[model samples]
Target: MAGMAAKMILGNKLNSVKGELGNLAGGEGEGNDKDEEEAALIEEARQQQEEERKARHAKMEAEREVERQRIREKYGLKKKVAEEAGMPEPDDAGRITRKKKTPAEMQQALQQQEDEEEGFMDTVKGFVAPFAEKLGLDLFK
Candidate 1:
């Protein structure tokens, strides 16, 4: 009878230890869930960082394009802005008549040409007038 009681006590102790082991495994499962949550948070943060980097790169590219446009326009960098605008080319030094121009610019060019012609005429007149009285034939003739 004493051996039977001792056997029953040993069985009860084994059952209690098994129950404690099950509880420990349950707690470890919760820890694994927490680890998963932390990993997900880390992934989310990485994704946000990637998005921010892309946004910053796009912003910088836009700014660079604006700067390039400003520089292009600052000096007349275009070979022919009128041509690019689907109009005739601007002045070309090689051409006898020069390039076709807008009406406004044409007027300006004409005024400049007249001024140059007048200056040249004045110079010629001054050079010939001094010798006119010396000769019977007028140099202006």
Candidate 2:
């Protein structure tokens, strides 16, 4: 309840561009330079958008470089060598990376692994059973 409301408020605050300009709400329907002003406003929005995009790109590049450095240090690697080692790309910090498998797929994979392990265990028991029987040494004994 409270948490969800807080998250909704936070998410809205993060995703909005309302604070970029003042009095956007003030000029609702009518405008001074209807066509020209709209065009200019659109251009301004585009320019602001571009600047934000470039800033975000620069920030991401810096963070990625930092992470790459961290990965290299953690793995005891040099930059050139780590670049060549072909590590997987990391997703953004907040995003989930794994694909969601369908229930059928999940069950199939789980059953397959279970079957393999069971088969191996059965084989081992089968091999030992004859020796155990000859020595009057059943598993229950």
Candidate 3:
């Protein structure tokens, strides 16, 4: 009698434990599904943004081409070499081209630039020296 009652109680407890464990596992599976759905949404948004950027870039390039064509037609200008067009070559980056010089010429240019820099530095040192001395600073040291 007492043994039978104890057996029934143990069986009920075992069944309850099993049910709780099953619920926990189901919860984890639902969480994984939600995570997958969120990841898909993020990837879709990124792809859409990339498509928009490409479209804008292509549109700008097309507009530039149209403007160039218009200018060429209006001026009746043909693409010609700079020398044949009687114009100096255009350096797009605005760098000036100079003829290569002999070693003596290079040394003279370097000396001139050094002299200019020295004069500027002397003026700055003159102004800063007094303040530095007032603060007990020794610039030469």
Stretches of model 3 off by over 4 angstroms after superposition: 1-26, 76-141
Runs of candidate 1 exceeding 4 Å displacement: 1-26, 78-141
What is the Cα-based TM-score of model 3?
0.37
Q: Model 3: how far is 59 from its true place, Å?
A: 1.3
lDDT of 1: 0.85
- lDDT (10s digit) by residue, model 2, range 29-105: 46555867889999999999999999999999999999999999999986544324677444447767765565889
Residues 1-141 of candidate 1 have per-residue lDDT tens digits of 999999899999999999899888777679789999999999999999999999999999999989888888998575435355778654466777745566889999999999999999999888888777667566566
**Model 2: residue 30 alpha-carbon error in angstroms:** 11
Residues 1-102, candidate 3: write the lDDT tens digits.
999999999999999999899888777789789999999999999999999999999999999989988898999976546455678665547557665565
Best by lDDT: 3
Q: Superposing every Cα of model 3 onto the true structure, what RMSD results? A: 16.2
lDDT of each: 0.85, 0.81, 0.87
Q: Clashing residue pairs in candidate 3, if any?
A: none
Which parts of model 2 are misplaced by more than 4 Å? 1-32, 81-141
Colliding residue pairs in candidate 1: none
Ten-residue segment with the worst summed lDDT in candidate 2? Answer: 81-90
Per-prediction CA RMSD (Å): 32.3, 18.5, 16.2
